[model samples]
Target: MRRVTAIVPALLAALMLVVVPAVNARADLLGGKMTLRDENKMGHDFDQILRAQQNMVGDTYITDYVAEVVARVVTGKRPMPFHVKSAVIANPLINAFAIPGGYIYIFTGLIQSVDTESQLAGVIAHELAHVSQRHVVSRIEKQKKVTLLSTAGMLAGLLLGIAAGGGNAAQAGQALVIGSQGAATAAMLHYSQDDEREADHVGLNSLVAAGYNPEGMPQTFEIMLKNKWYDNSSSMPSYLSTHPGTAERITYLNDRIARMPKEFLERKDDNTRLKRVQALIRSRMSPANTALAYWDDMKQSDYTPMDWVGRGITLERLKRLDEAQTAFEKALSLAKDDPLVVREAGIFYFKSGQADRALGLLQKASIMNKDDAMALFYLARLQAEAKQYGEAARNMRKVNELVPEDWEVHHHLGMILGESGDVFGGNLHLAYAAVYSMRLDKAREYLKRANELAQTQEQKDQVRELEDAIQARAQIGK
Candidate 1:
């Protein structure tokens, strides 16, 4: 099934390439209008495909941290024209990219590569600049001979191929896009040198305006350059390959940074959040052995409570319960008042069969941050384990509120609500969970059950709406 799924995009690319006339030859072809709405539509379509194919990180803490960084870059005293949404990809490749709309994707590798929040923010700002400046739309407009659908198909196929990393898949993707015009395909995949410089300049200003030190922009480029130096050219990151003129870019950014005001170059004092965010990624994203090795290699003097939290998680993943508990205890002792530390300790305790300890810590964490969906979810689980069905359902509902698209949360919430006698609500949530998980048949079954359990006309109407949504998504899958 996975193999078939992988081949489908390549097949589509091939079919489109064969059917559509060469973009360069068709001077008279009516190019699609590059309106904001059209750009958003394209981005939405691409986002769906990418989400289906990629392992997107669904942790609320990590995602929220990234969103907060993007918000600082894109949002200011002036409102943005379009809503920008960001997601973290689970890939270890050090790269980030923006689609046509305000859709930006950052890889875990990129997050791990940066030492500071401002450096991470610089990459985001650069991607956001690409969108805000309408670089993609402008490029599409320039290629007036190409149809939007075909171009989008070709681009998606090529990107998916590169992302998949298998030799055969990459070759198929390259063949589909580079059919008789490798140069043209390359041009389409990347922005011009002029556009790249403009994004750097615009992104630098936004980074400074958002109170990040302008030094972060040049520093980030330096990191990328260093990484590239250590890596073989064939193994070079996609970012470096697609984003040409990196050497020149680094030089330009450094020159710009040198001319910045003294006050603007001064670093911000609040990097605690950045450190915690990085710890979360390292703990959760890295393999257990790798994470343990990393922690082992780091000097003990540099280990903070957050670092202990990461070590605890890695130990837990490795099934070293005693050591994991000790790590968590050390973290709590160091920063007992910190909500994130409390939450991690709670989770570790729960996994170690100390339900009572887990409950207290999780409750404290929840109180500290009402929007902490992970804490709430764990609390709800503990409540259910204690046979407090009503309380469990309530907590699960809150978790659902905080993370509406989390299929697992919805699934657990549905079961809890069902056990608590809210059959209608349970079935509705179950249907939503199935839908989000792409279990269309299961979703249909749950929706039908929800429809039967609907007492109020309003409830029936809601079920009908969900049914319509399921049908629409089904068509898209086809």
Candidate 2:
């Protein structure tokens, strides 16, 4: 487990040194005239490390919602060299960033902190601008004296620091990379002041062109600034430290927004989906007590069906089954047609041992939104419990397609297929689940079994392909 964890970062570093074209006898600091392929390869490697080590939120609903926002941001924009992908990290820190290529990561805390969808879009646009502008590559090119080990160490340390709460851990990370060329390495990771300003300018333009309120840019900065004071910690937020001068940024963004046409500033994007996404994050990602308290506070004044849904979820997580059931019933009564509300009610019923009620509600939810992977997952599990192997396998297969990287989905699918006498399919999915879960040895074992069970040349070839991938990944560190 730890070996895979330790290997990928070093592998990424090695790739960067060997793949980057040398500029001169004195190494190029920034990116050494790296090609699009180099940037993408670096980003891809970093992304793997993140998926393996970070607490990524795998809920399909949440991911789909964020992807929709990304789509809107990139619409009509200049085509990126690499395909853009967004991921939500399950951390309660108000931060967002773009890795080299077009990979954007938003913390759950940032989503939870924003007042509206446009504000979130503003932050995303800023990160997207970083990738579009190739700031990471530029910064890497500037650090002429930094070694591959130091570069990798800095990237690993910074990411780990951000994941570990962006305080002491981040500072420790800086210290760890503070070798002979500490200043240069630090400069490489944190963009120059000019880069931040440029990103803000470019990002604001993209946000407005995408039809979002320009004010969202400043509003997001204000939120980050206010959070700085709210935290009152010995260390500032990683967002603040990494992207410095929040106050100045907020002021200028507001000035720029003011200078824009009144009509452009007033332009609105529908925030209904944004609110729903926030509710999901709060109910699912936040602590049970925290979510409970938040929903209780909201309902104390005026409550919507969504608020009731949130309360029910928090209550269920707290094991207050009776109260949770009542809350879900109320939510369902208030919004019988709402798929999310229905899904929550179904989950509540399932946990309370009312499989029939769970199945009915979940089935209804699936009809309402065939893409609701969570509902389908639960429905499949209930069917499996009732020994409806064929129906369960079908539903699980759909879910596996919907969330291919989800370890739990693959694990369940593997179990269902194995029970249904599809040994080859079962082992293949089990191998995938093991690989995603960083259990490389288990993955190899499953792949070997799958190879033995292959019924056709195509199946054998597929197994061999997977085996090669596993071998390559295993050798990454070495």
Number of the predicted model whose lDDT against the real structure is largest: 1
TM-score of 1: 0.85
- Counting clashing residue pairs in each candidate, in order, gives 0, 9
Query: TM-score for model 2?
Result: 0.87
Residues 1-478 of candidate 1 have per-residue lDDT tens digits of: 0011221221232222222223322334356556677666666656655554556776678889889889888853135556898988776567788876688888777888888888888888887887788876666566666532354555555564656654677767667666644454446665679888998998888888888887787677778888886754322355665567978998999888888788887777477777787788778776678888999999968889999999999999889989988999999999999999999899888778899999999999999988888888889999998889998998988988876766778889888888888899889989887887667899999998998899999998899889987886564412
Candidate 2, pairs of clashing residues: 29-140, 29-141, 29-142, 29-143, 29-144, 30-140, 30-141, 30-142, 31-141
Q: After superposition, how far is residue 396 of candidate 2 from its true place, in Å?
A: 1.5
The weakest ten consecutive residues by lDDT in model 2 span: 1-10
Error of 2 at 86 (Å): 1.0
In order, the Cα lDDT scores of the candidates are: 0.74, 0.74
